[model samples]
Target: MLLWNPDMNWIRNPFPPAVLALILAGCSVAPVYERPQADVPAAFKEAKGDAAAAGNADWKPAEPADGIARGPWWHVFGDATLDGLEERAMAANQDLQAAAARLAQSRALQQDARAGLFPRVDAGVGPTRQRPSPASQGRPDDGPSQASTLWRAQLSVSYEADLFGRVASSVNAAEADAERSEALFESVRLALQGDVAQAYFLVRELDAVQALYRRTVALREQALKLAQRRFEEGDIAELDVARARAELATARSESLGTARARASAEHALAILLGAAPADFTLAEMPLVRSAPPVPALLPSALLERRPDIAAAERAMAAANARIGMARAAFFPRLDITAGLGTEASQFDNLARWSSRTFLFGPLVGTMLTLPIFDGGRRDAALDLARARYEEDVAAYRQTVLTAFREVEDNLANLRILAQQAAAQDEAVAASLRASQLSQTQYREGSVSYLEVIDADRNVLQQQRAAMQMDGERARSTVALIRALGGGWQAPEPVASASPRR
Candidate 1:
């Protein structure tokens, strides 16, 4: 206690000041938080019954999706190229990196708010000079204003009392905001990975089409050569030879179109990996692998799976906390400031024990401030916070519904596509046989060149349709994986409404 004066009295702090602050803080005015519930089913509808019989043949049975890692999900397709592309996108995509930066900012803000929970201390050492007015110095009006310099070396501490939970509410809001940012970052990452995989699969599907067309071109060339020979030998008419040439030209043109499509898909993939279209090239490889079974999770588990849902829920919580902060504005605010230092006119005397000074009191003696009237500003803020919370609730519910729709949509696609694939396989086989029979008849002069050409076209079309079905199955598989949050793992229990002040 360096404070000493004949007119001043000394007092001892009887209890820990921190404990007193807590006792006086009482309770927060913020409404108790409750996690808004969304309509959820016992199980995914697409995973059972008539809708699932054909589709889920390629799908794994429903399982508890909690605590499972969904990463490396692309491996299920058994495509190394897809896995590689996903890794590249994860590491280099600008959008994902930008989301990570935003998460960092949110965490920093949380730390800033957390600071409000504890006292702030500062130490300063400096010399300050000032000139006093003659009147202020109690001198005659004509007296000279003399300049004086003082040296000070001191430590100060300040803390705001959470009297009505204002500090607590601010901290809560910031924490929720940080949590939301983290979930959003995960959401961005999952979307990027899915996009890369989807694009890769599309490129491979195009490769299959390209290969199919090229084979047809070679066959058509052989047919044209045979027709020319028959025309020279006077076994077939000139019209037959002309038709064969036309078929060959059509095959060549269709092959060129497939090539163009492949190039466009490849370029899109390159951009997803954070490269210019010209700088990236994927090797031509056909999509031959079947899409594997993705775990069909129960609907309740979905609440913990989707990052977007998590983020939306967190937004609601932050808004709820803001309501409390707004309500606290109508209550008294208390700030405690204290300092211990030495001051002297001479720099050399600043360190002397006799020159010591101390103070412990509210800044400017403003011990408390309860809002009286501010043109209804506090009331408006409270209303605004409540409105925002309601808005977040609506958004959160919409997100849940959208998630459900995505899962159901992909599941239906996979089911119907599976059934279609089986039928297309049979059609392709029958067409190939028909085309072979037509070619033999044409060679024997038992059928016109028109019949052979029609049969060949049917075979080509059916084979292409089968290939397209395979691509659709693969695409639907990837889409379902994304809807399930890109992995089987479950998140931590969500923050729920509590009565804690």
Candidate 2:
């Protein structure tokens, strides 16, 4: 009872045009998303007396991050060598490159998800051969074989209407995934830069230690020469000369140990710079005596500043989007399909308009699927999505808490190290003065060589301690900067008020 109507437009275009328009504003089954709250303090607990506030605006809990490009934070130290190392790390670090590649993958996936919002079209040309049975031909038992090649050319199209927001939810999830990947890439870059600066400082600190040992070795040699000359003059015993020689040997041994440590530190720094140890050499440079002051930002701003926290928050959003995607499976899904083509027994007739064929829409064609039963599959999937969202929520909160802890830990380190460095400086000065007094007393024969030796040992130990404390202070300052999202400037000195009349 089917009749061909050349003028029937509905038979050619089965998909309702209104569905396409509605898809843009499709109803999504996903739950409304909100950033889970965390316990963020107004000021860092460890930003006590030594730290100054960054004077940033008050808290923004769930505002999307502006970005992670905080500028070249390592420049605060004013070291050209460190600045160069950081530049090389950003350009060639393997981990950073890997993170970039992962980000690209996430963006590509987002593109794939966006594709679901539109229809698919395919074109093809092929040949078909078939023989019909006697019953199919409505003929006697000995029907003739109707085997023949049918040349066909076709253009087929299919589209899934976003009736219940399945496609929309998928698109939202993909967008969130891409954002999270970008944030993770930034996190890796910040960590890499921090590593380079910290490693460079550690190497320089060892250089200072080596220099201290060298000075001690030279001083011991000088003392040994003086003890030998005094022994020849019959002013000091052979025992005194032996003691001086022992001191010289001990200093040389310590010097070699320090040299070994420096070599290891240098090798490690070379790897961080993405170079072979044999090809890298650092001309010795002592750690700077003073650490630059780094001001602290308030805890509220720290949330916005750290890339890891931003990434965690985005993960929560992606999980929330997926929950909606799972819920959409419970609703009806619409698929629209259509095909237009030409077929003829002979290849020469396939191009003729009379041989045109077309198919569209329902009756095992365009389908609207309603899941009447699937045992517990849909229920399990919905539950799984919800659980994932909760897990990401916990992860996001933990990241925030960890960031706060890191900031406080580094702040405390810098403050305490500053005080320790000052005290160590005074000890070095006092020890040097005591050594000089002991030497004068021994040359005048007012004291034995034992007192002179003991005094010299104290001077060497105190000076080395001072050098170590200096390195610790500098390294702690770098750590604080990293915890504060890899960069912060010292507060400008308050300008003096204009002279009152």
Candidate 3:
């Protein structure tokens, strides 16, 4: 157990000189730290007007459902495969593992810094054989030498007297850096999760598109066969057969392209999940039709929820603490050292108390060092610290601005895409109807095969467009959630009772 003694006077102390010195070395000169201010908006710009009103009914301001775990925000998509992939990524992702290791390294460095506040004790023992020259007796120029074994054992203790807060300031700076590292780890984790989700969704979207193309290829092949039969039966021209075959080839080429895209997306996801591309595979799964409702939150909450913002804030604190450490270099430093040990020339008498010799009588002393000249080293360090603080402040503000922009951008995307999806749905239905009518009229000899071909192509294009829009809406929804900081929340403060007057 350690005791705290605020009083430094050693005159009346019953303890030894070493104890007194240790107790009085706690004074520091570092200034108190305060968080810097950042400019923030009352609300998001795009959160107003139609964007907010349009999705107001669908947006839920309450906490997410229990079935969808909060910290793993990807669970809200309700896809078991996605949830599994996220879990695997969190456990094995190399980038996240590296970030965690960095955090641990920072914590170890902080521990080393905190050790400066305590005394360091070390002990050592050594036995040596030495010969002494006898010429010092002045009896003869050449004389015999006497050999003896000497055993020496000693213990030493040292503590910095933090009289100017250099050690304390350094510790504070290290602690702040450790905290910054922790936030950075969390930032990396969030980014990894987001990347995995985005890549997975892309793969699923490509699957949907590829499936559409496959169906189109099959239908066009059938149409080609029908045109070939009609041309052989003298009912249609060779031009009709050629057009159908060309459309069929185009559909097949598109299907192959979509397959390539899906494969690329899958490979990207595999990398994010920390698996080899050749060894990893994701089964075909379609994206969920409806996007999970996003909870409404105040703009100020973003500052607290985003890990990157927290990291920036911690960086500013570290820089601020470093400034104090730099300032401390301009003042005097005090160190206290003490040693207690025994030395003996005879091995047989080494264990005996009478044979032990005290080197410096408890060996207690204080050292004060003042740098009268340093060629502006301290001043440069102070300037650098202040400059870093300013840089971190700028970065923090910029991060906040970028976060707001992302939220607004995704909100606009989701809103406009919703409208476009509705209109495209209607267009697809109309094209399908037109294709059916043209096919029937062609069979009844009321129109040329050209009308049927054009109608079929229009139907396929409209359907593909509708599917693409769905994929966009899903991707935008994921982006919006990521921008909202992925379900992070500040801890609730506990209420305390009022003190009596």
Candidate 4:
């Protein structure tokens, strides 16, 4: 029933005339991004007494070249030990390496999605053999044989043309996801830096405690000597000598405990830095005298600086693209295919111009898919995408709120710890004065040896407390920096800002 009419135009290039027009109209279906409103309170729940009032807007914004360093924020600590640890971790830490690999995978997937927006082509050439089936009848009774050999070559081209913009929308979604993964990797790196610094401070604190114990033990030995002399002279009971011995024994035990704690901290630091424990050793670092002041940055700045917030925002964009892609699926799709080739019954004539053959067609095949008969699958997908977008929006807001709360928490801690350290210093001084007075009175037979023993014990305990607070305040300061995304050195200081491809 099919007839070929030579005068009828059976082949036409669809892309040059019709498809290009459609593609220009349907380049992308994805909606442009508008940031969702954050539902957070005006101020953080834990923010107190001028903490929320302090912001970068109140301080001087840096010059274009004066912002925080983009890489290696830990350098601000000015400690060589910390710098070396971060370097080792970046090269060898397993968690960081895994995050980097995931980022690469996402980039590759984005490229794959981008490839779908373009035409595809293939070429091939080979010897071909054809055989007519015995049951198939044509001019077979006089035909050559069961099989015939020929030379063949062909080039085929196919293109989807993306007349509905579905392909472009998908590409947008993929690109956003890739950006999110990179942000996540940066987040992991920042968190690891904070952990290493905390562990390092803990080790040094133990060293200080052990040193304190050694001095206390020496004082105890002198007290024991005085107590024994008094017992021999029948001036005091043997109980005082026994008490002195017990105090010395307790000091020795405390020293042992401090050493054990320091060793454990060292091992933990080694694992974090991705090095063997045997190869990593830090000479005792003195406790820092004071914690750093909390850097001033506004609530809006927190959203820009934190990597988790960046990742969450990107996830929202990807979800929005899915909605456009799903909506576009309801429309029709058009594709075009073409082929050119050379064929010959004889090998010598295969490449000759006379043997060339070509075929092209403007195939207007349209897919008309309706959701009327589905088991609600299309609706479910749309619903899921919307729900995910809502969730991501909520998560983004929560991340911002948490960042503000953490900054305030550390600020209060730093404030109170400073006062505690000052008060403990006074306590230690007073204890020293009491011990000196008691020693003089005992030598003059004005008071019992018990007063001297009590005074020395009080002094030792107060000094230990002061040393521990110094380390705690230092650790808290590091936490504040991490919470504020490492000293506000803006790599990209605005939300939704992205690098051009």
Candidate 5:
């Protein structure tokens, strides 16, 4: 038998009236969210200065050709060994793999969170065999204790009515987080590329320096021989010969240190590529080539293009949604529950209509929170979210500023280093001429053997200095490219094709 109270009104919906009530009640407290905005700068500090020097022209539109212009940036050095190392680094880099895994996990969790917006269904079946007690049991025990098997099967379904759109908001928030994770993965990937490239360049530079040191050692040995001959012939003092011997020995000692430094650089590169040092070798350093110009980037476009900045912005969005979710807690939640089942004392009869039973109902739960002073936890949460939003904003701005600084620093370094390199090359040329002239003068007995030795030493130092400057220019260019986010673009939509993977 079923009963309805006289005072209650009948609701014709398949969903119970309580469900509708829950949804209606929630309509009052659902949080309305608006995105917070801080002013975006029109130009980056460094770019402004650069533009001022270049006649303040409008930022050039990025060309598709520009993407293909820089051929792997590192390849400019024309080293096949470096290309192989980079390939290995990308394949086995531990941190990059971790970041990729994290992104995948986030995507899975996003899907899971989104599922809460839909209904849940479950099923169960059980059979029990028991004997009724004769004394304690009811009328069924009148005929003595009886053994029987009871069979039951049921299917249940329940779904939240999303009264305050809490589930929707939460799902959206999770999706944003997943996107943020993906961006973070990209950021990590860029960083890894930069590290590997820089490490490789450093190793190559060490090779160049050590090779130069070996040549210096040889030159010093020659100078020592010349000094000894001159002193034996009574053309120079013993002190001059001793000085030459000491300088030669010092150069040899310095060569030993440079060799060690070079070995360490190679070993570090090996680790970066996940290989044992003994298992790999890099090609000799070729003539160093200057890196391409640092492409100009507009400040307004940088945040959108930079993966880390985008990730930060997405983080702010997720936090904002969380605030909405918390506020939605003050409202009511509507739930619909239904169960269909059959039960029978005999296994054979479990499927019969007479054994069938079903239940369908709607539940409404209003939080009805009594704020009766609980140390302001709810208010604290709101404040925390707001604070986090502000923090993200500040971090975003700081990242932008830092990005500008890096570009500027590298740009200035490249410019200044170029000048220094030009000067060093000139010095090397001058030193070489001086050495030649001193040799001629020595042959003519017009200058001491010490003058030729000094000229040769200066030439070696100048040559090494020039090589070091070349390496600096190359490394700085790489840094600038990385700081600009490797020229990556946001995935664009394609017509008649599936969305991004």
Candidate 6:
């Protein structure tokens, strides 16, 4: 019969001690994480001007129902082709796929870190045959040693006590890292969407310019024919015909260049959609000159809206947690290992109660692993963590600054470009009128053909410039949407019930 000592019972069961240690170690040493302060302005600098102010007053704050769908901001442009391309890019873009994979990896690492908080249990069974040396046993070597067979089955459990919050800190760091990765993934997705939209706009713009040049080429040919007829009739000099031919050739060259630009833009769009250039083609669609109005959000909203800022903030939190982990390294660590097993001389007798010899107990140990003599490894690690924290803080600030700058830049582009487009429209109208008057005068023999050629060239250039400006406005609108975080919002946290006492 085995006599049980009540006092030793606790020693044989180390789980109670481990639980108490874990409860004590629940106190975290990591600093409380607070988002670093950014210098934000009350209003966008460009949004304060008279033109912007008047425009803002005329444009009501766009409600979700009145404006583009928040989930797909590209819908605001009301372009079906753009919507289709964005969908395809999201489905097949390699960069987005890689970012998603990284996010998954970070989540897996978080799970691995979290596992440290729980006990690890393992079991094994094996049969072993061993021979002891007679010399080691202090016996005279006379014959071959006899082999003995031992069959054993064992189960073991081990758990770190987390005496200094190392496990908790590690888990926190991993969670922060995972959050950072998630933010980065969102950032990449938003960037891809923006790229597809911008590229699509650019291709359409090129198509419009190409059409304009084609028309200019026809007009120049007509003017050349008129010059030739006038010269043949001896009503104009051969210099006029030569000049007309030169203008026609120039127009044709421009038309060819425009076609090349359109092809290049289409190729770029195809790549954005993860397709080969040769396999992809876009129909000639007219440029959408009207940009959807964007609601002006306050500067503070940028902090919550920007994904890069969120990532930087999470990185800082992770770095701070690592510092706590490094500091915990200076303290004592507790590990508890317990095992239960049965050993027998033969496999047949291993399961017999009489033949079984059992051993079960805990081996509780505490290790004070202070790096006292290391070549400043601990100090260097701690310093590195702190430095990384500082770097993240600076990066967070910089991201916020950049976010603000992008919004301001796009806002200024839209505002000033609107005024420029108006002026350009007037220039185009005036040039058209001048070209018509010059042509009539040259036909009436009241002016030279050179004047008519100059007027026609101005009209073509002005019209092309106007079309290019429209494209710019559309592209800027997309940029502003991207700068505003592509309408992505942080998910609301679910509230958990209070724990029962």
Best by TM-score: 1
Per-candidate TM-score against the hidden true structure: 0.90, 0.89, 0.85, 0.84, 0.81, 0.88
Task: Specify the poorest-scoring 10-residue window by lDDT in model 4.
Answer: 58-67
Task: Please give the TM-score that candidate 3 achieves against the real structure.
Answer: 0.85
Scanning candidate 3 in windows of ten residues, the lowest lDDT window is 492-501
lDDT of 1 by residue, 39-141 (tens): 9987777786343343433243434332233446676676777888888897778887788889888889999999999999999989989998899879998
- For model 1 the local lDDT of residue 147 reads 94
Lowest lDDT sum, 10 consecutive residues, model 1, at: 492-501
lDDT (tens digit, per residue) of candidate 4 on 1-501: 112235546444324556467656755555677888775445444445333344542123443221233456665566787788877887788888788888888999999999887788889887878897654655556665478888877777877667667887889899989988877876787788889888888887887887888888887888789889989999888987998899889889988988888999999999888888899888886666655455545556667767777788888898888887876665666665666778877778878887786656443434322335467776787777778888888887887677777877887777678778889999989999999999899888898777877888888889889889988987887887777776544454421222222
Instruction: Give each prediction's root-mean-square deviation over alpha carbons.
Output: 4.6, 7.0, 6.9, 4.8, 5.5, 5.2
Question: What are the per-residue Cα lDDT tens digits for candidate 3 across 1-501?
Answer: 112233644423546776557447645556566766677778776675444554433233544221122355666677888889998998879998888889878889999999998989899888889876777656466777678888877677877777767888888889888877876776787788888888888888888888888889889989999999999999989999999998999999988998988999999998899999998999987655666656546788777767677778888888888888888888877666655555678666667775554332233433666788889998998899889888988998888888888888988887788789889999999999999999999989999888988998899889878877877877787788778777533222311110101
lDDT, each prediction: 0.82, 0.80, 0.76, 0.74, 0.69, 0.78
For candidate 6, give the lDDT: 0.78
Looking at model 5, which ten-residue stretch has the lowest summed lDDT?
A: 492-501
lDDT tens digits by residue: candidate 2, 350-443: 7888888776754363376788899999999999999999999999999999989988888888788778878888988999899999999998
- Candidate 4 has a TM-score of 0.84
TM-score-superior candidate, 1 or 2 = 1
Q: Deviation in angstroms for 84 in model 1? A: 2.3
Identify the candidate with maximal lDDT. 1
Off by over 4 Å in 2: 1-4, 7-25, 53-68, 131-144, 362-366, 488-501
User: Candidate 1's error at 440, in angstroms?
Assistant: 2.6
Model 6 steric clash pairs? none
TM-score of 5: 0.81
Model 2 / residue 157 / CA error / Å: 1.4
